[model samples]
Target: MTQTLEHEEVRIHRGPRSGLPLIVAVHSRALGPAVGGCRMRRYDGWRAGLADALRLSEAMTYKCAVSGLDFGGGKSVIVLDRNAPVTPELRAAALTDMGEFIASFDGTYRAGPDVGTSPADMVVLRRSTPHVYCLPEEHGGTGDSGAPTATGVLAALRAGARHVFGSASFAGRTVVVSGFGSVGSRVAAGLAADGARVLVSDVDGGRRDAARRSGYGWVEPADALGTAADILVPAAVGGVLTPETAARLAVRLVVGPANNQLSDDTVADTLAARGIVWVPDFVASAGGVVHTLGRESEGLDHGAAVRRVEGIGDTVRLLLKGAENPLREAKALVGRRLPPG
Candidate 1:
């Protein structure tokens, strides 16, 4: 069956010169402004890119809402090739384009960086637009959001392990972190730092080697998830947790920073039947939201934002004990409330 949008609004703009300008689906008018980071990914076509932007934006909307933040969700996708950011000039051009594209919406839907984008990259985009939020300290922004994102993910993973395997420590437990990107790399480091034996895997050999040097075990991408680890964290691409991979899982709990970690709701049910306590993707992987959370630059008083996300433990525990999954409960709590920030 085709998918239907329960919450969100989508907008598309194709630049006359080249590249497609996309504002993914945004959810909630309750939030003053819909805030999100922009991502430049390798897409087969504009249509595919559009779908990705729309879906991610919607997920982000609920992510912020459930975290109890007032910001709505929005995203931008710069479609080109896998090697989109080749040189300084190329990267600069992309950010410049983003500034122009996103400026159209003003603050209605804000965009940052994702996938191949970085905090430094956001600075370039900021030059063209003052609307940017996550910047380096030099640019009057905190440099590393990866750390906060990783912290939130790690906390959620611990919560999942406790609720599922009835264990609180990861002394002897093994965890495989796939796709060690910006967030994933930090997550791997954080987990290892937490005394968990972490096996790092990424599409980029350089990054994988770096992780290995950081005291993490290394494995090929496919081999990473197949191990008999107590926990399996997918920090890789979306849709990797389909039936085939889902069935191959030998871990007790799953938590990671990948978007749409499951292919769909079916993956959740499959894991449920197999007795694998699968943490909801949107709920477990809310680190990016925490890192990106802000209202005033001088110092963002997130209040309970970090606690709220780490507290996803409570929600996960409730889902484990209740009839519906954590995502359902989160969906209900968020309640289409993306009021302006």
Candidate 2:
């Protein structure tokens, strides 16, 4: 069975030999072309993969809208087989075919990097399609967007700090980052640099080792959510802040780059009722999209992109202080730019 949302288009593509299940969901294009990252994961089934694509694409629309970008939101999910051996040739064949499939959109949808994908993979994608972004600097594209993404998250964290603790500095505050990937590592490093007691956790031992090397404290992934912290940043996966986990959270603020952090809409009310200030993931994680759009569409230099990302702090502060429901406020902000349904 195929599923989709209103004002959305879902396309399923299959590779010849690799049998890659590529699901692309274009959630909206009311503003401009749809843009989002390409995610690769081993899902339980096609239904779960499609659901993820639809949800992430819709979230991208809100993220772009809240970030003041002119593009709409879309996402591509490549479902991998857990038992299959991922040889180099198989990977290349799959990506090449996926690139061709993306190129068929003719810029209506653009794909970058997400979970299990990278700038290097974007390079592979460019081998077949010109519709890719976030390539290496030598390739004349914006490099990893994680830096600016982390930058924006840090800015929003400070804004949340001020809103909750009456100070903007991270000095003397305890922060737990639940992911140590490209974005999470940068956030942890930034917090450590700013004198925050940064603790990091990841399922990967290598990432935990890296966090230790960077002088940040380490927590096991199992204990990350329940760890004592002034701020809890779920930077890795989504649906982590479920009602059960939210009930046990030991933090005053929830701010991170994880998309769809809440398991469901009701979790927002759960967090709020628990007195935990929740910064909308779209608002907190928009720096990457903002940087990518600024550089790719607006011809912005690195410094200009950084400056634009810094504005995320102001936006978060405004939303937190002025709106009773920040997520609804963000959606309304996007709705104003979109044509009426």
Candidate 3:
């Protein structure tokens, strides 16, 4: 194990056999045990993975705080080899190693699934750690948070629409959803069902095909960001809205489930200056955490959790209408609740 501690707590672990490199960052323990997902992906380098872990862990803290969860922020990133095929054996070995690493944290950190990870992987993780969540429904855990997450995004989108266009209804509105993955696909479908002119795009051919089969207008990945629409949703990955991209955005509102949506913090101000209403990603994308809290905490079931998640719309509305800077306001909301070290 080789660990580099930032102002926030962080741990780096290497798999004994698979040589898997993992970074765990615990941003806070003020409210309770740190809670976040474990993201497995190929990074440019170990340092890049470490940076991602740090950024995501801090976001997790704010996410929990904004969602009214009694948990701090933390995240784990498993670095993979891009050149190597991630076979079943490789995935199992890597997850097993990660589970053991998580177990060492005791109860201070709880792990769940993120990008490139799934409920099935959580089952494997549960073999080594009792703190794993989002396991298979048969295992008494929430199977997948995609539905709830989409619900939250939908709610937030409506709220943003109301704030920006003075209407909450999506009827006749064009919603360009970039990245038709698990959560993005749900979001796009929900918008379409609600009578929105939904346009979809994804880097993967299969995802684009899925969008087409679902009757959504397919936009190429290259033009998705520049599409003229009522709302531009970057649901794929982070840093898509850099200062340059924000300057060129044609939408009135920018809202999506992608974490760290702003390439740089200043991009929020830039968007604001350009007359674009930017809903903070943490507030809009907190449905999964709400679901997790309901499952992990006492007296809250999935239905109740979903109802709680719906409150995100109201939260976003309040923040957008009141706060001068929604991002800073969201962070302040968490900072006020955080306990002193």
Candidate 4:
């Protein structure tokens, strides 16, 4: 937390034919390879895209390190106009840009997917560079890591439940989930399947209806926290849990896959004081990153990857067990691994 901007790197990438979109590199820590996802977005502009990528990548480093993963954090953002057509040529160029950028960093950074991206994109990325991971295997794919990420978030939620209610089981318990995107949708589904009565919300009415038809309880997006649930999972976006909003939060646990979930450590302390068990974002949301890593050109087959990720339950348990300070312990794990200098 004390570190400044001394080590971060921001770079612009270009291809021969046009459209290289900006790629920002934020090397927050270097315990190991800088690992993060490539998020393609309709950024406001080049500057905005770069800033988002830099901050996100840096956060990933802290998240991974805190979660005991030996990966330094780095994030990539592809600036694109929202209206940009996903023409085959444009898509190919995007993948090529990824390759060019990865070629620059080499071992220092590993790439995965984030918002506005998917395993399918990874396949395209493989066209330009073999650095892609988490593809669907048939296209010589490695598969999507979204499910594993949801699983990790589920584990953290279970741990948080114990801290709040003395049990991790959500049977008959009420829970609300906001966002309903890739991570959020899976989280809601997982919670409901585990016996938690779920209240779901999303800006997209179609997604909301889909959840309801899928048997998930439904509610307006604004009504999530007011649903009188045992847990509130905000899987939507960062800064959603601000001081004012958090003060109004009436839930026993807050665990989700959203990065920067709390905005700041003050929120962490606030949650603790309110008797709301907050599983740190980095710890809870790392399944996807780790899962992506499992599919790396470094070889861990599907079965092996599944076993390794499911085994993360132990790490989550340890972090939650009589926690002296889950955050501190996780951070210490990172500090210990970094060499003396």
TM-score of each: 0.87, 0.96, 0.95, 0.88
Q: Please provide, for model 4 over 1-341, each residue's C-alpha lDDT reduced to its tens digit, 9 standing for 90 to 100.
A: 67656445767776454475758586665667777888877867788787778768867876776655667788888778766666767766776777667766765776776787787787766666665667776876656777888888887787778767878888988888888888888888888888888888887888967887878888787777566778988788877777777788888778888887766667666766677767767778888776667656447776776666665566667766776456666666556766544
- The lowest-lDDT stretch of 10 consecutive residues in candidate 4 is 332-341
Return the top candidate by lDDT: 2
What does the lDDT come to for candidate 3?
Answer: 0.87
Instruction: Return the candidate ranking by lDDT, descending.
Output: 2, 3, 4, 1
lDDT score of residue 171 within candidate 3: 90
Clashing pairs in 2: none
* Selected candidate, larger lDDT, 3 vs 4: 3
Pitting candidate 1 against candidate 3, the one with the higher lDDT is 3
Candidate 3 Cα misplacement greater than 4 A, ranges? 1-7
lDDT of 1 at 26: 65
Candidate 1's TM-score reads 0.87
Model 1 regions more than 4 Å off: 1-8, 16-24, 81-90, 294-298, 301-309, 336-341
For every model in order, what is the number of clashing pairs? Answer: 11, 0, 1, 4
lDDT of 3 by residue, 196-273 (tens): 999998888777677778888999888887889999888999989998888889999988999999888999888888
lDDT of 2 by residue, 1-341 (tens): 98534746789988776788888899999889999999888888777888999999999999988888889999998888867778888787878878888988999999999988888899988887888999988998897899999999999999989999999988999999999988999998888888899999999888867777888999999999999889999899999989999899999998999999988888888888888889999999999999988988899988999999999999889888856667667677778877877
- How would the candidate models be sorted by TM-score, starting from the highest? 2, 3, 4, 1
lDDT of 4 at 188: 82
lDDT string for model 1 (1-341, tens) is 99866555676765544454544556554664777777876787778888888778777777777666667777778776554445666556767777777776776777666777877888877776777766776877655566667767787787777777677667678888888777788877777777899888887888856876788888788687688888888887888888888898889888887888777777777887788877667776766566556424324455544554466666556656664455566666677453333
